[model samples]
Target: MLPLCSCAVIQSHPTVSMLVTHGPVRCGEVRRAVTTTSSPGDKSRQRLRSVRAGAALTMLTPLCTLVYVATTWSAGNRPAMAMICVSMLVLAAVALAGAQAIERAGRRATVQMAGLVVNIAGFTALALLDGGLKSAVGAYLPFLVIMLAVGMPLRPFLAVAGLAVAGYWTVAIIGGPAQMSYAVIHTIHTGIIATLCLRYSAAMVSLQRRLSDLSRIDPLTGCLNRRGFEERLANELAEAERTGDSAVLLLVDLDGFKEINDRYGHQAGDDLLVWTGRTIDEQLRTHDAVGRVGGDEFAAVLSGIEPDGVPVVLERLHAALDGVASAGIGYACYPAEATSPEALKEIADRRVYRDKVDHNRQVPAEAAVAGARGDGARRQSAKVSRHERRRRAITETGRLGISTPGMGLLYVLLFAGGHPNRWLMATLLTVAVTLGVTTVAAAARLSRSSAAAMIMPIVGALQFTICTVVVCLDGGASSTPALGMLTTLPLIALISPRAVLLPFAASAFVAIAVFVGVSSTWYAIGHLTSALVVSLVCASRGRVAAEQRRKLRELSRVDALTQCLNRRGFMERSTAELAHAHRHRRDLSLLILDLDRFKEVNDSEGHAAGDELLCWVGATLRERLHPHDVVGRLGGDEFVVLLSSHSAGETDDVAGDLEAALAERIGVSVGAGVLGRHGTDLEGLYAHADAELYRRKLARGRGRSRRPAAPADGNALVA
Candidate 1:
């Protein structure tokens, strides 16, 4: 009794029912919707294969029975047996031929159930006509049970199994008490097989469903991951196209997400990502889909939305996101902005990038005004303490470090029991035990990653030293203990930074030279060469990984348009400058500059021209400012400069010169915040400078005096 249909039975799984119903539609809803609404290509292919296989099995079984009856049965019995087999064979052939059509018509289960009924009827006829319960044909009943139990729904399978057992039992009872005992044993055997096969089938189906869920879902966010999102989006777009409806593809990226990770920790970052996914889900319709497409980036596909309605949707989404961290959103409408999902994604991503640039520029100015009105800016979380990172690193390193040596100790005692150097082996075991215990204790007490970093390499070195001594005592560099030395190289590679690699390799090479001097064997030479190659390979890989990390960090910090520090970079650099000023009592000043009537430039001369002007400003500032001074475009038309070691008077002079230089080409306004007179921290300095800049812009707009006298401190100046 094969499964009529192998499709997932979502409602049958009690586990799926336990999913929360009230939250934003998550992976569960998405999975259920896709499973129900879409004919997935993989599943369809699998269904076709299952149908073909079942058909082949169906035809082959009856054909084999026909041949068996022809060879073994009497001529009188042969005719009836042959008739039953031929009927099943014809049914199987029809099923095989109609498999594709059945699938297309969505009547596979109906056809399959019909086929099962015919098969059972044929089997019962053969068993009764041939020799009743004692006939070999009765054995086919259990095989039918096995087939039905595979993929058939539970209740149907049980029904079939019970029917099979009853059919066999009835035949046995009819054969009289002489066959009753045989029937009892056969019935019990068939019952056991059916029960086990049913249990196995249930477990397999459950596992298959679980795997499906895991593949689609992002475990942390409980939303669809990239694969799931793409599948859902593709199906949605297809439906929209067929219905002549519209859809919206929205791409969202979290601004300053990396800064959040750095300032807080990865745990907080993960929580924020989860929050972002949920937030996006909350904003969309239940029919719409949201997915985490990249780190700090989410994508949503909204069906049945017109182009005109997109703006309202976007506005609402932004409003919801604005309460938390700033977000950049870009959306494309199907058949309006772009036809295909890929095109829509590309256009949306470009818009998101543009939105992020605009957000960066506007937020700083807005935050400044908000702060001046006594609305404190959102405070950043304190950076993860150095001690905490170190402690975690140590603990992680110890798990591997302690376990390896403990295993080695066991290996020595278990496998090297017959070695002649008993004292040396004993010494190795003691050393390994000591190292494991000490490493565990040290990891417990250690709070710094640096300490863990140091301890690990030292542990590796000690392990190598002991191993090296054992090799020398046993059989020199050519001995089996030589391979143990190779293990230390990877440990060193794992724990030690790039700087340590060279020195360590060099020292190892010198040690190898001394060992070679004592006993120069081909094995020794080969072993030494292998060690060098392994070291080089690890070094090269480490270098590449380090370089990639560096580039990613730099990309995160730098502005793409201006090639200057972005907001995150500016804040980081400014924080360091402020700390230095406080530590050494050096003068520091902050200048906030806004392009006067910058929107006019864009309005009169396109965005490209405005971008060109912005780029020129960045270049001009980098030229005029000292090599040590910092320059950054905060976003939009706003820029910030930190003049290092500049006194209040010097800062004012520099501000005036910068304003004059920029004014020669375009209208510009500058405001300066002196070290002590403004505030101590970076936020305080930025707030004061932003306020002054805002006032200067207001005056310029109101047709009032362009230049105001320097304030009492002489450091507060408007240019």
Candidate 2:
């Protein structure tokens, strides 16, 4: 079945409904949100073309073989040869037709099933080609090999194998006694080899599948990792360009996730991330892609969104994140705002940070304090930070732990066939595969992602150790030390190269001592020395690249002027605080403030003095509020604050304090709103406070209009 989804929207002037679009993804599967990614202009159609080309290639081989056989060997029974040639051509055409149908439907199962039927038919026709089965068997065996060459999946391959065995039995029945025994033995040999080929093919497919998943997925949340998200965005960009369509890219970052990880424990933090991913996925359509691009950030691709539809789609996404987490979303449209994927990403990323700043600036007083404290007073798990968890992962596993099964299979192959440890290697491969799959479920259940990073490294290390011992037990006959060196080398580069070396080297020394004895200590020393040299080179290159990226990310969100959290940073902090406050039934408030007559001052004084004045205002506000309080400027002279644990009265007091401080200067108007009373939403809170500010400004305007009949010169009015 072609899995697809449709969305319908009915809009009115007043309120927009939540059910504007129906998506295939239900709520709560954030990390596992599914997207088609393939539109009319995507690579899926290109692949169909490739498959058609393959079909043609497969067709030519059989056609040439049939014609050659008919011309060269159809001596006495020309009628039988003619019949066989016709059957092969007809079978080839039918097979191509079946493949074409599958290409249209894009179904792999059809490929397997159709290929099986065609292969069986062709083999049966070949078996009956000559004067008798005896003469035909020799000619028919080559076609059986050709049948194996068709790129059918495992099930159809097995079916084809069974049919070949059946054909051989029919041949044996039609043959003389001597021919019958020879056919029986040949069939048995063919069956064994086919079984092994099938097994190897299955393993290769499995390995490819797991590796592909690793590149695209976030190991912890099971969402699209950064690389995967970027690739999909590129595809979306291509689709939009080719088809003249429009799509939106939303870069979502969790507000206060660092605090959550710091306070509630990394485990709680991970659960929150999982919940966030699932929530975003739930809000998206089947054609939308949600990816965890940063530590606490996710990006989404919304296809089929009209310019007007952007607001509704964004609203749905916000609603999903309401209580669990506060999210700052930055989005850009293709063909509208950006011409390329990188441009789209840059625009969205900048906007997301700006939104985060707005959120942070409006954060309630107490929430800011709690955030600064960096501890979940309500539910702190074992003390673990995101960085520490990462440190442990690399130091322990030396892996991001994305593709353990694939890596382990390589280790198995390196251990080779003759080693007694080959079976041991096989067991390790199975365990590694099982471990990688189960770790996700386990982490979800445990609410700890550290386990995800830790398990695979241990399994890999253990596998290496076992392989080494098995090789040593056989008197170090194999290149055991060499395999050990290659496998153990990742441990050096993935972690702090210098830091991890001592323990790794010590462990290697003991193992080598136990196995090779004192005479080969030079081999062990050489291994460690050379490995260290390589590790240092890798570490130098890796750290520089990692550092450059880290700095770029920091530069992206930092405010150029006031040096406070910019608009996006404020929003990033505030959203999570608001959500946490709501979830816990804690008091929360918003304060929107703006300088009176700031534009007049800018006109009178130079723009430089105006900038200095704005800087002073930012500094003064930061000083008056607690360290936990987040302050942000919404361009121009407007400012906002998010106050956690602040009641209506406390909200008023804070607002009044800031206003009194500013009264000596150009003056500041403050508007306050409390959660549950003023509004629960970030946008609503700002609107409510801004409304109050406008009300006060209007009152001042009326008062000033009545009292101020100033002289034209203005000097007499002051006196």
Which of the numbered candidates is closest to the native, going by highest TM-score?
1
- All candidates: CA RMSD in angstroms? 18.8, 19.6
Evaluate model 1: give its TM-score.
0.47
Clashes of each: 10, 36
- List per-prediction Cα lDDT, in the order shown: 0.59, 0.51
For residue 171, model 2's alpha carbon misses the true position, in angstroms, by 50
Q: Write the per-residue lDDT of candidate 1 for residues 525-621, one digit (tens) a residue.
A: 4344434434443344335433443443454456656777765567778877888899999999999887776655654554456667888898888
CA deviation > 4 Å runs, candidate 1 = 1-53, 98-105, 360-719
In model 1, the clashing pairs are 1-144, 1-147, 1-148, 2-147, 2-148, 3-152, 361-635, 361-636, 390-448, 390-449
lDDT of 2 by residue, 30-59 (tens): 222223444565545655554554444445
